[model samples]
Target: MFDKIRDVILEYVELPKESITPDTRFLADMHMNSLDIMTMIGQLEDEYDITIETEDLNNIYTMQQLVDYIEERL
Candidate 1:
């Protein structure tokens, strides 16, 4: 699951595979904007059949955090 999410983000972002470490910050480290995040969230919702609240999205920062959030819905 994490790999899939990582792959999708990597497709649009320039970050390397090694940079996807658990501690990497999505916005600061990966340089993702809100649109990138929303798009990824949309893809995740479609793939997992779950809705992620906007408030919760803001709280997702690190790679581990995002994976945990997605896993909860999964």
Candidate 2:
């Protein structure tokens, strides 16, 4: 799942796959703005067939957190 999520993120950002870790911060480390995040979320939803609530995004910061959130819904 982490690898799959990383692939989605790569579509929006130009970063080496090895650079993105579980602790990588989407905003601080990846330099993603709100729009980038939203776009990625859309892809994730389509890929996993799951809906992610906007309000729940408040608690997600790192890669692991996002993975966990998606896993929970699965």
TM-score of each: 0.91, 0.97
Evaluated against the true structure, the overall lDDT of model 1 is: 0.86
Candidate No. with top lDDT:
2
Score each candidate by Cα lDDT: 0.86, 0.97
Residues 1-74, candidate 1, lDDT per residue (tens digit)? 87888888886698778778878898888998889888988988888899999999778899899889888877
* Candidate 1 Cα RMSD (Å): 1.0
Error of 1 at 55 (Å): 1.1
Q: Candidate 2 overall Cα lDDT vs. reference?
A: 0.97
Worst 10 residues of 1 by lDDT: 10-19
Q: Which 10 residues in a row give candidate 2 its minimum summed lDDT?
A: 7-16
